[model samples]
Target chain A: MSERLEEICSIELPTGESVGVHRRRFTGGLGPHVAIVAGIRGDTPEGTRVAHAVARHLSTHHERLCGTVDVYPCVNPLAAHHGARHWPGFDLDLNRRFPGRADGHAPDRVARTLLDATRAADMVIELRGAHPAFREETQAHVRHDQPVALERALRANVRVVWRRSAELQGTGTLAAELPGLICLEGGVGNRLTDGVGLELCDGVLNLLVVAGVLPEDALPFHWAAIQRPLVATDEDIVRVRATRGGLFLPSGRMWGEVEVGTPLGEVVDPIAGETLEMITAPVAGRVLAMREQPVVYPGSLVARLVAT
Target chain B: MSVVFRLEAPYRGEYALHRLTFGGNGPAAVAMVAGLHGNEVNGIQALNLVAGMLRVMRPKRPVHLLPCVNSIGADEARKRWPFDDRDINAAFPGDPEGAPVERIAAAVMDATDAELCIDVHSGATTVREHPHARVPLSGPELEHARAMMLPVVWRRRGDRYEGGLVGAWRGAGREALQVRGGRGLALDMDDATTLARGLVRLLAHLGLISHQDTGTPSHDTDHVQDYRSMAGGFFVPEVQTGERVVSGKLLGLVRNPLGGEPIEEIRAHKAGMVLAVRVYPMVHAQELVVRIAEDAT
Candidate 1:
């Protein structure tokens, strides 16, 4: 069986140049169709990299694969090209335009097209990177109500499996549009993180196996190589915010365990270089995410922790 | 005029939210706000014009005008708060104990407690809009919009007003409506003045002021059509906002950017008043080139 690259939607620029959102499909015998989508936001290159990595593996093993696997490498190419979070000219967040209109703007049409293409699949997997301002540990996020997604996320190679409640699922988000969608996210935004891409690629391949789209023996790595992720609910997560406006210097390491009162970071006066505030861990947990951007404001989120 | 809310800034001195008051101190009849999006200069100019008019003809009831709510945003000509880059308008009915924008939003809610409230805005920077009031299809809001007698009164679904300052006010049980004109970044003085006149007319209709200015009735309709480009190119609009168009009128032309060859000609299918037109020439495929508020059939 040969792999096929299909164009789902085309974005035409004013210069008569065109960019297309594509899907790479791998089909063998008829089985569950699993959709792997990435790069909804331009800033998240890690997700796009993972999508391609998975695509490359599927391409190499297309003859051995069962069922169908559709991988959308990068949805928002324009934003990805400029390394920005939103579409450049429109300055609109593609993530917020889910279930978009058929006759709307460029972003809206792409969003609508993406939803239509992926909605019919048996399983949909969304790949994402943390916000550019923060560096995050590998995690799989599934809606709390979705037991099947939660069950599938357990097999996804990641540090933590966060089950976000219905209330936490913001309106207009892709997660809100698809109930059983499993969102695999990790690493820093824009720039790819070491080992993160490999873990996610392995995870996607494992999912293909779990969905019966790919044969278990076809996976390059053993299924046992997948890490057992900690299952966390909304209550298990803690968000730490800064109390002062200054430059934040993170003292904690990524995925490092912390005790109560452990020094997470310090906020210093940007100009005077004086310590304005010392940020301490409020609970005993592991650092889930840390703000890499130096600038800080009162109530600005600096870190997120998952209580052990 | 007085400071309604204040926040201590780390680098800059204290941030102040000011309100210009007119007439008696009794329960305010109306509270008008603008510049929630700092780059939208038309609303700021319109409110300022209203403020200027209110100064001379003292309204019988108290009126509050909070012009340029996001002063920091206006300073940098940004839509969101400068410090955190968060939309202040989105943080409506906000928390005083929460983020900076949230605190400001909460303050705005408290300070603008009135029987009626209005949030003014301008179209996106790339599009130009005529002065219009967007209200529900029916109810007191529609009646009030009709009283404004602006160039256009577009009846929109209540669901569309789910998250902004207008939504917050409506949620709090205050009668609220939104009016917009011109475009962001640059001030179209004519449109701004037109919006101001409409507001003045509404105040007079409410018996809040003694002045009687019967502004021309609007082209009222709930049905509006947006014309989008089928292909990407340099869009040349044939009509301006507020211009009346007939069937088969050449609304715009999409021409190749490099060469002068015309790609597509957009024509109006039915007669209507132009509600919005794209000011920026360069357009992507499916981009909104024109919006027409059709006459009721």
Candidate 2:
């Protein structure tokens, strides 16, 4: 079976130029339709990389695929072109313009088109990267009420499966629109990390296997290679914030175990190099994320730990 | 001028919140603040003008003036904090130990201990708004806005003040209102003067200062209609801010970016004063081009 590549949305620039957002579709002996979307925010290149990797694997095993799989590699192409978090000229976050207006601006039109195109899919998987300020460990997030999504996310081969509450999900996000949407996020924003891409690509493939979009025999890696993730609730996550405006020097590693009061980082005066504040763990847990950039204002999130 | 709050900025000098007080401390205290959005120069100028007036007038009760809260942002002509791009106004009832903006917000909230508080602002960069007061449909704030007697009095719903400094002040059970004029990143001396006069009128209404003529009464209304561009183009506005127009009046024309003919001509749907007009020519689809506070039929 051959693959089909189609233009999902076209964005018009002020200079009379147009950029096309495309989707790659692979159909075998139709079992279930799954949509894998990425690059809603241009800064999240990790998602785009994983999307292409999954697309490449699907292309190679198109003949043995059990169902239809649609890969939206990059939705906000103009923003992706310049590596910006928002649409270049408008400064609008495409992710926030969901279930958008048909007759609205270019960003809103693209959002509406993408939401319309993926509404029919049985499963929708959104890929994202960590915030630009931090480096996060591999994780899958599902709405707390969605048991099927939670169950599917557990098989995504991530280190943590977070069942987040509706209040914490934020407004206008893709997951807010699609209740059962599974979100996979990790690594650094804008820049792809070593092994992170491969790990996420493998995870997407594994999810495809579980969804019956591809046969288990078609997976590139052994099933045993998948990590059994620690399921966590919203309360299990502890956000560690800086108390002083300074440079945050991280002392803890991502996913590293720590006891209560463990020194997570030390905020130092950038000029004098004097220790302004020593950040410590509040609970015995594993560090899920660590701030990479040094500069921090008071109350800046320096690190996040998942309580065991 | 006395420093009410201070915070150590990382690489720069310390951030200080300066308060200019007039009259001795008393039971009747009124606080007025501006420049929460650094780019909004009109409010800053208005407060400064008010400050100039207050320097000579002997007030019966205490009056506090916070002219420019976001001095750092004002220096760079940016609306948000230069470091984090966070809106200081949004961090209201803020964290004293939070970010720089949050600390400033908290300091502002703490400093504003008064019977009535006023937060002043300006229109967005792309548009120029007539000097006006935005208040609730029926409340003390509306009466206070009428006392200011600016060109326009926009009586809106209570829920509209659910966020920002005005909301935070209201949440604290204080009589708070918002006043705005001109445009951000630019100065309109006339509009600033109008705003200053209106503020003084409010002081006179409160019996803090001797009564003086401010200006003509504002066009009071509760119906504000917004006209948005249907397509991305160069919007050429036909009407200016504060101009009155009837329905079917040509408000603006959206011309194609290229040398083509006008793509769309937007017309007024209601008879009212033009509260706002898009000054910037380049516009995106659904961007506000004009706003009219429709007169009740």
- Per-candidate TM-scores read 0.95, 0.92
Off by over 4 Å in 2: B26-28, B97-100
The lDDT, on a scale of 0 to 1, for candidate 1 is: 0.91
Off by over 4 Å in 1: B7-14
Candidate 1 C-alpha error for residue A210, in Å: 1.7
Docking class of 2: acceptable
C-alpha lDDT of residue A250 in model 1: 98
Kindly list the per-residue Cα lDDT of model 2 for residues B216-284, writing each as its tens digit.
888999999999887778889999998999999999998877985798999999899999998988887
Question: Model 2, range A1-308, lDDT digits (tens) per residue?
Answer: 77999998776553345689999999898689999999999999999999999999999999998789999999988888888888876667788788888887788888899899888888999999988888999999999999999999999989999999987887677888899999999999899999899989999999998888888989999989998999999999988888788889999978999999999999999999999999999999999999998888777788989999
Encode model 1's per-residue lDDT on A1-308: one tens digit a residue: 66899999988889999899899988887789899999999989999999999999888888887788889989999999988888889989898899998887789999999999888888999999988888999999999999999989999999999999966878787888999999999888888999999999999899888888888999999999999999999999998988777789999999999999999999988878899899999999999999998787677789999998
Docking level for model 1: medium
Candidate 2: which pairs clash?
none
